[model samples]
Target: MDAWLYNGKDADDVFGILGIRAEGSRSMNSRKLVVLDEYINLFNARYPSAATDSFIVLRDGFGGEADFARVLSMAKLRPESERMIANTSKYQGELFSKWMVEDMLEPKGVLSTVLEGGSYGTARSEDKLVVNHYNVFYKRRTREQ
Candidate 1:
């Protein structure tokens, strides 16, 4: 497990000390989190046809990223899709400039993900599980199986 995680990433061999009794220190790095609220605005600007939708619905009842991305994948999307993709890529590049690549790059590209843990399904102690580690596993080699 340890080797799988640290194999190509831990260039300093930092993770190599995991099981050994070792000490470390830390400090706070100040960073300004830029919250992007331009989605609705940009959507409206780029897709004026969507303006008929209620603002309340747009604000409080935004659809899932999967739904958005799925629609975005359709072939005929025009000004809106182009603008959205361009702006999202811009935001990602901006974030990476201010932070570590590890902090900015995400599996879903434009969406943040939550971590999941615990045994997969109904696994016994000896059973090898093939859990979907989601973002992390997808970013690297398939952790499942």
Candidate 2:
């Protein structure tokens, strides 16, 4: 699972990162939906063997990034399916820790990802079995000048 961080401040920022731009009069949500659909379509074309539903989208309630991060880490997702999500929620401050990308369907054009948050699923050996769930957070990968 390759990790990418997008600066959610403007449409152009998103466009450059996702490789899609909105046409005349397209609302942000509409643009996002279009990107999501296109992304999924493109993704499906590459991985015919992986079932279609394996991909999931976690949209921010208000359409920003933080919410995107939250849903990205939800425990309900299947451990093996690849997920591609665009966070449209807002985030305050920065965050860090360990994240794992379990698989990469198409390593270049489009990527399908399996995320393991924080430490690997197991606790230190000889200790009681503890489910170490990694809390996912959005950290800025690029600092805009």
Candidate 3:
């Protein structure tokens, strides 16, 4: 099971660390957006990694399902440095949203992959970038009903 811990701080830090730039772009590709939206629904429907599931759901709430999904898709596709900035923005928005609603909840991890220097932030590592077994059990092993 791949994984990274986040304590909720630091833009450069991976895992559950809170970052600094949690408010950047919200716009993204429509097809990837659709894929991400479905991905979130799958996450919610499955009994996979409980830790990250709650975080993703909670983060979705902050930006609205659509907005969060866009950010998430972008983050998934973005390079590490770009993700550092983009995720920071998204995470910050979610935090503020939760605070304003007085929910006082936080996500477990902020999973992001490293990126090569490129424009669409499409650059990725040859190594597996997924941070948890959520990808394994849900995305690879499970069969669709």
- Model 2: worst 10 consecutive residues (lDDT sum): 103-112
What is the lDDT of every predicted structure here?
A: 0.28, 0.28, 0.35
Clashes in candidate 1: how many?
A: 0
TM-score of each: 0.19, 0.22, 0.24
How many residue pairs clash in each candidate at the backbone level?
0, 5, 21
Q: What is the C-alpha lDDT profile of model 2 across 1-145, one tens digit per residue?
A: 0122222223233344553232211222344545655544554555555423212232223233222333333312322222222222211111112222222122111111322223332423211111212222211322221
Q: CA lDDT of 18 in candidate 2? A: 52
Candidate ranking under TM-score, highest first, comes to: 3, 2, 1
Candidate 1 vs candidate 2: the TM-score winner is 2
Q: Candidate 3 lDDT (Cα, whole model)?
A: 0.35
Candidate 2 segments whose C-alpha is farther than 4 A from its true place: 1-16, 19-28, 50-55, 59-145
Output the worst ten-in-a-row residue range by lDDT, candidate 1.
24-33
Model 3, 23-80: lDDT tens digits are 3233222232333344444443452443243345434433454344344445555636
**What lDDT score is found at residue 52 in candidate 3?**
41
lDDT of 2 at 12: 31
Clashes of 2: 5
